[model samples]
Target: MNESKEFLKEYDDSKYKKPSATVDMIILTAVDVETKARSVPDKVLRVLLIKRKGDPLVVDITDPYKGKWALPGGFVNYYEDLDAAAIRELREETNISDVYMEQLYTWGKVYRDLRRRVISTSYMALVDSSKLNIKAGDDAEDACWFDVKITLLEEVKTQIKAGYIRKTTYELSLVNSENEIKDTVIVTKKLEGRTSKIDLEYVNNPSGLAFDHATIIFYALERLKNKVEYTDIAFSLMPEMFTLTELKKLYEVITGKVIYSRNFRDKMEKQKKMVIETDEWESGKPYKPARLFRFNPDWVEDQ
Candidate 1:
């Protein structure tokens, strides 16, 4: 025992290399926009992105990917907790804080970062943009909310030596508040039947998003789609009070599908604890006012 204690006292952690840790944020919101084709307001999904300032070094090499758009992130402090690091990095880069956030995933692909060995733990948040003031700070050159639209371009299935592989391609379009196309990213994801796992890679990303952030955004969206069905997380992006139609539209937008009104209402009715009818209604509209409803805190407690 004394010999082992002596060996431990002389041990050095530097003998084994360690990967650097980082935290990235996916801040999402659903905003109401006026459209020429519709009398009522249309809800659009938006994501916050930051432009990199100064020169970026890629694996000890200065690369052309510098000064491109990327998610708000930074290296984690040595003494900080993972969740605290995520929230602190988000606030430092975007000037937005105190929103609903949860851990999304950890990305540790060997080549994900050209700079050193970096392992990133990402967090996802849903916020009402109107309530918070946002600005670019720290290493961020500029920050803006871009309207996000994802379209499935194609899906292919191929037989490999071991098993079957499914490949799907998606086009991600980022539009500015002025409704102009700011950037477009094409990503392809592959699912292996043998492992039942999916991996994503960039096909043609003109947006020049740093690292594997484009894939991270897509993964976060997929998780949100699944969570909205079984959880009250969707309410985080909604206004304090909204009509049933508004809520339904929000769900459809996130899921990228149109749901029948009757069926959706039926599901909502069955989950009576999820929402409560309020006496307030939308005002200053051409048609009859629609009743407003708020999310029930009781349901959250039950969950």
Candidate 2:
């Protein structure tokens, strides 16, 4: 018995590895036009999250993660096609109707899950905020929109392109054609008196969805920041037509900068990918209604 124990103790443990997981991204977008170009605001700018309802038999469902809202996502099924899993997760959890979907990224990290090592692929989708009537589906307790709070100095709005401190705060609310809604927990972020750059403050989630999801959400924000440059994803949030002021605000919100009007216009015109439609309607304010435009049908894909 002693000899057998000694031999077993020499067994190599380095080859032992945990099973991996696949994650599908439910990328949400809103329309934001800056000058002549319409773009999608970064995920940090706008997103739809659902509180998870892990319980299977609860009637009318009273779930802990149910009341808490986060993005609609889940683990991939065995031998399942990646795209199919994303569709299943969306339909079953968010009850989201017809909308365009696409692959965003794959997230597989050893330490991403605390219980075990797993990897997930994040998928993206674009939807018009006004176009869809969204509801929480089977596993979601509640569904709500949480605007990503990024920092822009009233001073930074006046000065640099990226200097605003992306602070966090609990004050969060958005009003739509429906009614007022609240999130599970409010995130509070603050800058320590004009620090040159921004840092994450604190996020509160009462119905934790196991693993590094909070961190995954953070990663999505970075993806939005990059995609806005080449794709018109932000426009998914805005009205069909808007003034230059509204357009600039959209950019300021995403790019985190206060832009000079002339420079912004000049840069957009050169893109030569936007079209001006002849219909004009004013906001009935002091300024004249700016010319309404759309992506040049042919130039959009190329752009």
Quote each prediction's TM-score: 0.88, 0.63
Candidate 1: residue pairs that collide: 59-114
* Model 2: per-residue Cα lDDT over 1-303, one tens digit each: 999999889987779874766655555555442333333222235567776655523333223233434567777778888777778888887777566776766666555544556678777665666666668887677666555543322222233343433333332333334433332222323334455543332244333433445545554555666766676665665566755555556666666567887765654556644434447765454444567655444556464
- For candidate 1, the lDDT comes to 0.80
Instruction: Give, for candidate 2, the lowest lDDT window spanning 10 residues.
Output: 150-159
Q: Pick the candidate with the highest TM-score.
A: 1
Predictions in order: lDDT:
0.80, 0.55
List, residue by residue over 172-216, the lDDT tens digit for candidate 1.
777785433333334433445546666677654444577878788
Instruction: Estimate candidate 2's alpha-carbon lDDT, on a 0 to 1 scale.
Output: 0.55
Error of 2 at 265 (Å): 1.5
